[model samples]
Target chain A: MTDIAGSATRVADIQAAYLAQARSKRVMNLILIVIFAALLIAGFRTADRRNAGGFWDGLPNILDFPADVIGEAIERAHLLPGYLIKYLPSLIETINIAGASTLLGAMAGLVMSLLVTRGLGPVPWLVGPLRRVLDILRAVPEIVIALVLIFMLGGGPVPAMIAIALHTTGALGKLFSEVNENASLRPVEGLASVGATWTQRMLLGVVPQVAPNYLSYALLRFEINIRASAILGFVGAGGIGYDLRNTMSWGAGKFDEAAAIFLLLFLSIVAVDQMSSILRHRLTHGAKPGEIHR
Target chain B: MSAQALHQQTRRNFNRKRLMSFALPGLVLGYFAYIFMAFDMAGLGVRVNLENARTLVSDAYSYKTHVTQDNRTGAVEIAIEGERKGAYAPGTAPGWVRLGETSEIDLGGGHVVTFGGRVTYDVPGYGLVMAEPGAGGVNASLPDGALPDFISLSKNRLMVKTDAGRLTVTRNRAEVFKYSLGWELFFFTLDSPYHGMSPGALFKAAVNGEAGAIWQGFVGNKMWRHGDVGWALLETVLMAFLGTCGAAIIALPLGFLAARNFTPLGGLRFAARRMFDFLRGVDGLIWTIVLSRAFGPGPLTGSLAILLTDTGSFGKMFSEALENVDARQVEGITATGARPLQRYRFGVIVQITPVLLSQVLYYLESNTRSATIIGAITGGGIGLLLTQAINTQKDWEEVSYYIVLIILMVMLMDSVSGWLRRKLIKGNGGGH
Candidate 1:
């Protein structure tokens, strides 16, 4: 009986220690939560203080601009189709910028990925420097290049295209290199044994293996590039964004035009989003459900 | 299934592949041709300003010192980059310039310029180019030889450009610009007592109790505004952090509403999902424009715009994650007599916390880049400063500086976010 009692007390002591640890852990988590909350609050307050308008004051007027634009758009509903037709060319230009940049960037990225991949690379010493170059290219926002180019090249779509392409090269190069690392080197070795050039080896041995994944990533980059190109247009690079800026700056009178541009942009983005997602899904999954293979 | 039939099929496949190979390149070339025309590539050559390119390239790495003399008063002034902020004090000038009745500027390479009642540029290869500026306009004379292409003389203006320097004479003033390497007044302006100190001397000064003063000089540099730039960089980073974290926080519960397994109500899920779609589809540019209209402009507007758009993105992603959560964990929690909320806390939240945190951290780094672009649109943070510097067109050095800082800022954020993701989501086994 004394032995049983001693065992029970020992078990109780262990339970007490576990509970204490649990309690301390909870307390530490609570403190961390408190600190995080404090940081959020402080950061918001600082941002508000630095802002041109206060949050509360702006909250009520948040919907006012949208409402006004929508109201005018509805009031001038008949002109909507005409405005859409008018801006169609600009929209096409924007899409072209995105598409061209994606194509050029993807090509550049393919070269860069092949150059940087450990197994495929010709010059091992260049890999680190090339990676750093990509990082720098990625780090620079498109607007910086676009704005600088605007200074030298003047306001046009070319600046935005170059800017977006440079960024896409960096982004897609990184992704492509990651894809490249997983590729089998047996084909490359076979090609080398057959006396193929470096270019021929990469094109034949690796390109076929990673083409699907590369296409999927490039499609995603194209989607992003569309948005980037539009944003660049807002800052004096030519396109629909330029038109939007002009209409917006025109204030109340041109709200209808602004609305029209907004609808067009929204519809295009959604369509692209849907189409690309479906394509990506198909690429990854090989085919749709119950599709005939013939 | 005969050998002949199989051979025919193989031939067809090979032919189709060959056709595709040729057709793809042809199509790509065709598209490029179309784009070249559409984008007016032919006109771009004419549109490109080589002079502006030269200025931008040179100004990014080099600065010019200006020596100017008033024709009426003969008051001479020496300034870096010809900015009023970089003016030399009275009775003081660069070593190459000798301040006297006639300010004599040694342009190096045996080229010299003197500015007073008369402006004289003594070119080493050529003879003296003299110009007298008065109310009657600049009367100029060049050496009695074949005039070099670098010298241009007219009734009102006389200009001489050489490898050493450039001299321009007009009725109102005579100015000589001497080109030099490196950014001048980068750390301390002319007013700072430690302006001309070498790095070794600066260290010695700091050791001798002048560290604070030296720091103040650097921070308060009239030419650079390092302190303000630093604050702007911080604001940009803060915008990204606050926006990303706020979006994640706001989206977590909404995600529960949108997820099929969590919400149970089809109507509520549809509504929530549609709201997410709408927010995301509107895009950040539109949000920024709309928000800036209300909030005027600042880092707050930028952050809010980021928050609003990212909330949509996070909502969709989080809901998807929630829908994929393992039900076994919830069952295990429930077997312990845990309440519904307790089950969710232990099973659902715990399961998705790593995913949510990693996604949020990833967005934080990307949003830093986005914040910069948004900051430009909304007139806040370093983007504002960068845009302003670029807009001026004359401040290429400042533009380059801001570009370097932005690159560093983004790389720093990239590494930091990557580090945090690794530290926080270890052993979670979720796709980043």
Candidate 2:
């Protein structure tokens, strides 16, 4: 009977200890949440203070611009089709810039990935330096390159293409190298045994293993590049964004044209986003039973 | 499962693989061919400005100091990059420039230019070129024989260009440009007392308790604007932090409302999801343009633009995570007599917090870059400074400086976000 009493006390002691730990954990969480909330409020306040217009003052006027644009667009609904057709060439130019850059970037990224991946690369010493090159490339904003190139290349699609391509190479290189790390080396070794060159081995042995993943990533990058190309165009690299900027500068009356460009841009972005998602889904998760060899 | 059928299948697979191997590259090549014409690659050569390229490349690594003599007053002035802020004091000049009535500028490598009543450039391998700026325009004399391509002469102006330096004389002034390596006036402007001090001397002066003055000079540097740059960098990071964290906050509840399992009302879920889609589809560029109109171009505008676009993304992603959550945990919490809110706090929130945190942190790093781009559009942060510097076209060194800072900032953010992700999401799962 005395042993049973001791056991009951031990159970009570364990329960108390657990409860104390639980109480401290709750307090810590509460403190964290409070701090987070405080930070958010402070950040918003600081931003509002620094802003040209106060947040509260601007809040009511937020919908005014959108409403005006929409109203004008409805009034000029008949001209909308003409404006879209007129800007079709520019839109196509923007899409082509993205496509060409994605292709070029993917190609360069492929080579860089093969050269930088640890087990797959021919030169072991080059890995660190090449990785840094990719890092710097990835770190640079596309607009920086595009602006400089626009100054030198005279503001066209080419500068945007080159800028986007360079950034893509850097971003895709890093991603591709990661994919390369996961690739099996058995096929590479088999190719090497037959005295295949490094390029050949990488192309035949490694690429086939990682092709689907690479394509998926490249497709995603293409969607991003489309946005980047449009932004670059706004800075005078020549695309639908250039037209948008021109119309925007004209203000009041030309807002309908701006609205049309906005509509086209939105629809295209949504279409690309949807299409790429479907393609990426196929590339990643839709491998049929007989497609394992790929 | 006959041998004949298996052999036929293998042959067919090989044929398809071989066809694909050739067809893929062919398709790509055809696309590139079309792109070549579409982008007007053939016409690009004529439009390319090699001179601007040369200037950009040379200006990036080197700076020019201007030594000018006004014809009207016969007074010589030496300034770095011809900027009034970088002008040497009335009686002071660099060692390469000898300040006197007849100031001699050693452009290095036997290229010496004398500026006095008339400007004379002594070319080592060639002969001396002299020009006098007077009422009758720059009467210039060059070495005998065929005129070299380096020298261009007109009735009013004469310019002698060499690898070492360049000399130009017109009716108004005679000027010499001496190019040197590295950014000039980077640490302290000529107005600063510590302008020309060596690094060792600076250190010694700091040890002598002049550290504050030295730092003041460096930070308040009019030319480089180090203090402004520091603030810009901070503002950029703040934009990213506020935008990303704010998006996560706004999206968490919206994500739950959009999630199929969490919100029983189909219409509410559909509305929430569509709201996300519309927000994302409009794109950050449009958001930036629209918000800048209301906010009038500042960090607030940039952060809001990022916040708006990322809310859509985070909402969609978070809802997916909420839907995929295990139901057993919620059931277990409910069985313990927990209320609806308590069940979500203990079961649902705990399960999704790591996923949400990791995604939010990942967006924080990328959003830094986005914030920079938006800043350029909205006229805030380092992006504005970068664009302003680049637009000047003559401040390539500053452009390079901003580029380096941007790269460092992005990389630093990248690593910080990675570290936080690892710490917060330990053993739970991985992030994109």
Candidate 3:
């Protein structure tokens, strides 16, 4: 009894409370476990003969002859350091695709965001359907949009740009609206008190507050678009992916070269990401009270 | 016009900054319209329809078959294994042969077969086979041999022609030869049965072709595929989750450290205030890829990546929540001379647990959605599935199905997370 009493009362009480919570959550936990199990079973059950002629074949291909892959990679690795320098052309292209797409997407997102912002639009006519459109727009995968755009633009940088922009608008628009919604009502209210119209208050007061956030989000979208742009070439959009398609098609087993490109891309993204975080921190935490960006 | 009327005009211009409200939406719509026109939706629909028609034809197998042996126009063929002789109609269901590499057909009874995607794709239809010439290329360019007498009649008048002495195939495996984005788009599309001509296959073909040793040459670097695309997707998710958890863990301790009402030591509280500034200053992706390369791949790199990224994010969120907490309970802890950790345990942590949970759930939802993309680049998980899909262009309908599954998984996670947050933070389900 003394030993039990010696235990910290805070720890014991907290444990007791946690246990109470867990006991109540048992039903839910069990239900989730069962649901997850069922899903897993269904997925596995459905997984039939794989790699009839796709990535699955790579396994058999690998096991059957490791030398082919290894030999090519080793040989390619010799020339890869020099080939790595060649990534610049694609990198520049990627920047262009991302920049153009982000510019286009931000414009669309800005409009849709404003229309859907409950605080700004308030009226259902503007808010309701726009929100649904944004939802549907986001619902479809970006690749599908890319596929559809390929039809129109005929598979160059243009289709990929348009596809990225469309999806980005929906995603960024949602974020923008949240920024608008959380916007301090003080400035807007003060503007209204001075008899400024709804539109006027949003501009002089609302726009200024949320601009930094919008910019940050737009920059983030650009980073994403850059990645998307690089991949678009798999479908013939443009960039280094076209080269990848060819290399894989050749099956010369130049995995080392492919691996190098991958390594570089990952590193570059990391750099971009660091910059974004710093920018976000500055925007959010730098300013004082009302000076803070929405 | 009076002087007052002129003054009113200037005031109107001042307030007219609101004009962006009306002009802006219209302007945005105008730009959207311009983009839509630029995409040329009508042309793309036609191309897709053409491609779909070709696929539908191949899949449907609603064609008549005819074979000419040397000069025998009408088909009169006999099998030798059991010496079974039979007269077959020119156009009839032969039975099914497994049409795709992934899709296997029984063809037990006839040529009609059933198939499915890892699940079941058994459909009733005849898969025509070239009887005499053997199952070879559609176009018979067999070297040093006379054309054997066999023909396959498949969907859309599937017919094999013989040139001089070789069998010829005209069916389009891919339109990549077209020299347009259409060809690339066709190749880009995943979800097809044919494997050889797809981007991945083409690469393999080039590798195996005379260009085998080109991989070792300066020219070899041109083969650098978008392999990293796979890992990027994995890296994104791993970092997002771990970073978030790290942030929560750090914030919990620091939050207590900063809770002035709970901690009589103002010095410790001041230090806590600076934790968020330090933590939240870096992006999650940066943290992950750097770690991945440093640690040399796998979830460890991803975990560290997430830890670095999320610490900042969660620290910010948590500190904000700490500021809004009620002071009364915290003050009560201070009045008792309890250690700093004890007061925080009693005062801040308990109070903000619900808020922390809700935010975590929200972040998890976001991270899960983004996780696929990171995995794509990092060479791990389902992003691999997606990357393979784009690279191979095997069959997109199946890809669509997978996409739907992922979305449902995300939605399920979101709902469950929300429910847990609600239940835990504001508990009230018990009679005890």
Candidate 4:
């Protein structure tokens, strides 16, 4: 009976200690939360001070521009379809830029992935340098290259295409190489034993294994490239974004045109977003029984 | 199934595969062909400006010093890149330039230019080209031979280009541009006493208590504006940090609202989901444009733009993560007699915090790059500086400098975020 009583006392002491630790942990977390909140408040204030207009003052006016555009667009709704039709070619140009760049970039990225992947690389020493190359390519904002190219190429879709492609290559190369790492090397070794060249082994053995994932990643990149291409056009690379900028700069009288362009961009982005997601879903999880082998 | 039937099926599948392989390549080829015409690749060759390319490439590595003489005032000025900020003070010139009544510029390969009443260029191979700027025109004479293509002569302007330098004499002024390697006035402007100090000497001076002075000179350098660039970089990082963190903070609760398991009311869930979709569909470029309209082109607008766009993305991702959370943990918390908020705090939040934090951190690094691009459009951060430098056309050295800094900044952020991710999510399934 004395032993049981002693053990019960020890158990109560241990529970008290655990409660103390938990309470202290809660206090520490609360302190952290307070500090984080303080930082957020301070950051917002600093940003407000640095901004040209105050946030509170600007908040009310946030919807003003959109409303004006919508109101003007509604009044001139008759010209909306005509404007959309007129700008259809520009929209197509933008989509074409994205598609072409994605294609070119994916091809470059595929080769790079093959060259850089651990088990599949032709030269081990080249991997580090090639990875750094991709990192630099990815690091550079497309505007930097696009603007520079615009200076040299005299303003066209080509500069935007090249800039976006370079970036996409870097992005997709990293993703593709990651996918390549998970691929089975058995087929590659078998092909190598049969005296297949490096390129043939990669194309026939590794490519088939990772093609679905690569396609999915490339499709996602294409979606991103579409937005990038549009933004590039805003900086004078030529497309719907250029038209939007033109209409925007014209300001008051051209709100309807701006609205039309905005609608087109919105619809296209949403459409592409939906289509790519669906396609990626299918590629990843909906592979047919026979498709897996290929 | 018989072996003959299986063989027939295999043959049919191989034929289909063969047909698909050919068709895929053909389709891709056709698309490329269409793009070629659509993007006008044929006209691209004609559209390219080789001269601009040469200038951009050469100017990125070299700077030209301008020696100009005003015909109206009889005053001579020497400036780097012909910028007023880079102009040399009176009675001061580079060692290569001898300042006197007639300034003699040594263009190094035995090529010398003397600027006086008449500008004389002594070319090593082509002899002398002399030009006199007058009220009527630039009376000019070149070496007596077939006039070389390098020399462009006219009634009003006489331009003599050589391997070492270029001299142009006009009706109002005579200017000589001598090219040199490296970015001049990068560390110190002409006004700084430490302008031409060697590294060894500068270090010695710094050791001898002139460190603050030297640092001030460099930071306040008018040509490079290191102080301004540093601030711009900080502002960019700040935008990213505030945007990403702010978005995560705002989206966390909204994610709960959108999650089907958490929010029982389907109407609220639908509203939250559609709100996220609307925010995302508008895109960052549009948000930047719209926000900049209100905030008037600054870092705040940039941050807000990023915040809004990322909120949508984070909302969707966070909701998905919340939905996938193990329900047993929440049930156990409830069994402990915890309140609803406390249960969620220990259950769902604890479970998804790693995923949420990792995603937020990943976006932080990417948002740094996005902030740069947005900053360009909104006229904030390093992007603004980069765009402004590039727009100046002759500041390719500065452009290169900004580009290098931007790449370094991004790489630094990438490594930092990657390190944090490893440290924070090491044993968690969230590890990349």
- Give me the displacement of residue B218 in model 2, in angstroms: 1.6
Q: Which candidate leads the pack in TM-score? A: 1
Write one digit per residue (lDDT tens) for candidate 3, span A184-279: 889988998999987788778788899998987887777666666766665567766655555545655566555555556655665675686678
Q: Please identify model 3 stretches exceeding 4 Å from their true place.
A: A1-99, A110-133, A139-160, A176-294, B1-247, B250-304, B316-329, B351-355, B428-432
Ranking 1 against 4 by TM-score, winner = 1
User: A175-267 in candidate 1: lDDT tens per residue?
Assistant: 899889999999999999999999999999999988988888888788778888888999989888999999999999999999999998888
The DockQ for candidate 1, computed on C-alphas, is 0.50
Give lDDT tens digits, candidate 3, residues B158-227: 2332221112222322000000111121222112222125457656656776344322322222111223
Positional deviation of residue B412's Cα in model 4 after best superposition, in angstroms: 1.3
Q: How many angstroms is the interface RMSD of candidate 3?
A: 10.9
Which parts of model 4 have CA positions greater than 4 angstroms off? A1-35, A286-294, B71-74, B132-139, B207-209, B427-432
Q: What's each prediction's clash count? A: 0, 0, 71, 0
Judging by DockQ against the true structure, name the best candidate. 1
Q: Report the C-alpha displacement of residue B166, candidate 4, in angstroms.
A: 0.8
lDDT of 3 at B161: 29
| Best-first order by lDDT | 1, 2, 4, 3
lDDT of each: 0.90, 0.90, 0.53, 0.89
In candidate 1, position B372 carries an lDDT of 95
